[model samples]
Target: MPGGRLTHGDRRRIAAWLAEGLGYAEIGRRLGRPTSTISREVARNGTTGDYAADHAQRVSGDRARRRRPARPAEPPTAEQPTEVVRGFVDRFATLLAATGLPRMTSRVFVCLLTADAGGLTAADLVRRLRVSPASVSKSIGYLEAMEVVVRRPDPGGRRERYVVDDAAWLRAWQADTGAHARIAAAARRGVEIFGAGTTAGTRLGAMGEFFTWLSEQMSGSSLTASAVYDALTVLAALVHAGRPLTLGALAGALDWPEDRVTAALDAIRRQPAIADPLALRTVGPRTYTLTTRSDRLSQAQREALHR
Candidate 1:
């Protein structure tokens, strides 16, 4: 009964509890239901001061009657069991919700992530999640704003489908790192406001430094993580060879395509001077070497070494 759908009797008790001015948690404890369940019920029905249990019960019954009948259970497959996938979606959505994503938004994201087509229409999400179309639409907008989801025209219909592809994570990372940059700026402002000599200012200064370092590390390049990794690998190869290598030679040595090697080198060249300790130099046509920058060391470290 604790986890089952709320009955008309439950609604009546909730109305009575609201009349008594009891909080959601207290009502939930008395009813053996979760606080969220109690809160959602009241919020859906009406406000605390004007809840009508009978009306709420009638509306809920009508909505339930309008819903499509449940489909027959499919047999479990060796590759992907239906029950297993359902459990995974639920658990994953919960984990995402814990990370500050709204509960319904997390559910919608998990649904899209697990969809076989890698995309889903709002109708599909509503049916699968058993949520209203409005909820699905709102979640989609939130995910799109974060660049974690993209909408494309559905091939089969006029309705658009939402997709979360490989590049979605890269975009999400960039968006999140952008927030870190803003936070670093705010911390710097705090340091200035509090005065650098004060305790608060010192803490803010350290926080600003940490966020700045973190933001730089994650947002050094607009390239995807894999591209950055490939660039680093190319740099490592040059370091190990201790000499300039032709594109062909590097590609052969790394067992990668020549184009991939070239792309990696190009990525390294595009990095800002402050973002990378190593620089790519061309000593001969189509040949490249990695050189450590003299300014790689901090100013204080350079001064210490000179002394």
Candidate 2:
């Protein structure tokens, strides 16, 4: 496979392919390059209708010359080898891409995540990733939209830097929970359209219930993701025990402090009353049990279950 930057000859062939009305994928296939490479090249140089190979080559050379002086120096570190870190970045980016993130966006996110200062300017990203400024800009925009990255005024200069921090993860979680809420709404709409008695409606209803529950668990009471996770862990433990247990017993079972267990129970109690099917009940003095709420299912669903 062809690797590295596109050559002058490659630009000429791309121009010829554009004149032939070949799509990016087809041009990439013929040139032995990825579709994104061909697309980015054409987009950076000119539109399909007016692309000029000579002009593209001249501009590409100009960009390279300009970027040469701006490239940041990296001092070798004994603690973490540069090659090993780069390899890990590539591998993690591939895993993120497999999870349906756009490949460039995944690469950009991982780059920001691994930065020593927890942030990098656009120029820094372009220089480090060896990608076009436009590619970096597009990837940053995608990450910003997903709430996984934020722009802050650079401390050293006027340029805005993209930073990924603890708050970024919380924002990303909120964005994800918003998606689950939307799915729940859409599923409920499907139930309405298909009629509640139909098989499709029944399926959609179940989907709606699950997504609604998930969205609630994820975003209820505006709790932090870690807090929600802790509460769920405590709930899970109680469910596994299958009997009422004192706070000390619960804490011992989970290897957590009694105060931490108390906090988790409080977080669970703060959730909206209808948010979950299971509830934490105080069955005896200083003992708690998990109980299923009888009202979790609708009348129609309950009757159907009986039938």
Candidate 3:
């Protein structure tokens, strides 16, 4: 339920809605979800190009089986000690993970989003994330470049703390959407490399539409606007470093287990025109670096892909 999968009742309603021939956007509006949410839910679960109320329920349940967190949530009662700080941290972590964010970038964002009072001095984050000051500085530099978070001098302390303003995250998200459209365009160019109608080329072409549509959908303010970029945030992580990374190092740096990192690296490296085909380098033994050349490569690849 972290990503809020549809309920059985919701599935039944979806089937009913489809049976009545309601459009996806209309259905999504009814469900208070994005059209992508509705389309994905049905496409993933609708068996045999046929919408089934009951089967769709099972498919959705299956999708969420492994996705749910193991820890039992505390009761949301008056007596419960639910803290916004903890909620914010958990939610931030969940969103970052969904987006396939780099370990260092995700961790820095988690700190920026969840920092209690101080907003975390460099010394504070250095201590909290247990990384070198250089790592913190690099990650902060990256985040500032993205405009996801801002850095301000602490009034009471000598050190500066990274801070995320209410608006800063939205600014970062706008930057990110632009980035995705750029990458997707690169992926589209692979159609030329692979030839259109070929499997790889087809997927890449679709990717262009996906990125374009996604960016267009998020061009304003709303909870869905905030929530939807969680996916892009994850993808943006891939473009963070100029080169590749090692799965082990990536997992360790992100505080994720080794296996998940390996799996993701494998999946991404399989993409056409990834520039660097090595998963190990993308994950990295060294600190990740995003250079000007990398940005240019991303843009060129995107333009080519979109062509």
Question: Rank by TM-score, descending?
Answer: 2, 1, 3
What is candidate 1's CA lDDT for residue 241?
99
lDDT of residue 264 for candidate 2:
87
Over 120-189, each residue of candidate 1 has an lDDT whose tens digit, in order, gives 8898887777789999999999999988888989999899988898899888888878898899899999
The TM-scores of all predictions, comma-separated, are: 0.51, 0.53, 0.38
> Which regions in candidate 3 have their CA more than 4 angstroms from the true location?
1-98, 116-118, 187-195, 220-307
Q: Which ten residues in a row have the lowest lDDT in candidate 2?
A: 76-85
**TM-score of model 1 vs. true structure:** 0.51
Global lDDT scores for all candidate models? 0.84, 0.84, 0.64
**lDDT of prediction 1:** 0.84
- Segments of candidate 2 deviating more than 4 angstroms: 1-74, 77-81, 220-276, 279-307
When 2 and 3 are scored with TM-score, the better candidate is 2
Error of 3 at 278 (Å): 41
* lDDT (tens digit, per residue) of candidate 3 on 1-307: 2247677788888888888889999988898888888888777765425988788777656766778757877664322324664466556767886787766777778877766545767877776666798998988887778787777888986778778878886787778767876877788788789987688987787787567556544543333433334323324464664455454555655676766554444433333122222222332453332223232234457689779
Candidate 1 Cα deviation (angstroms), residue 181: 1.6
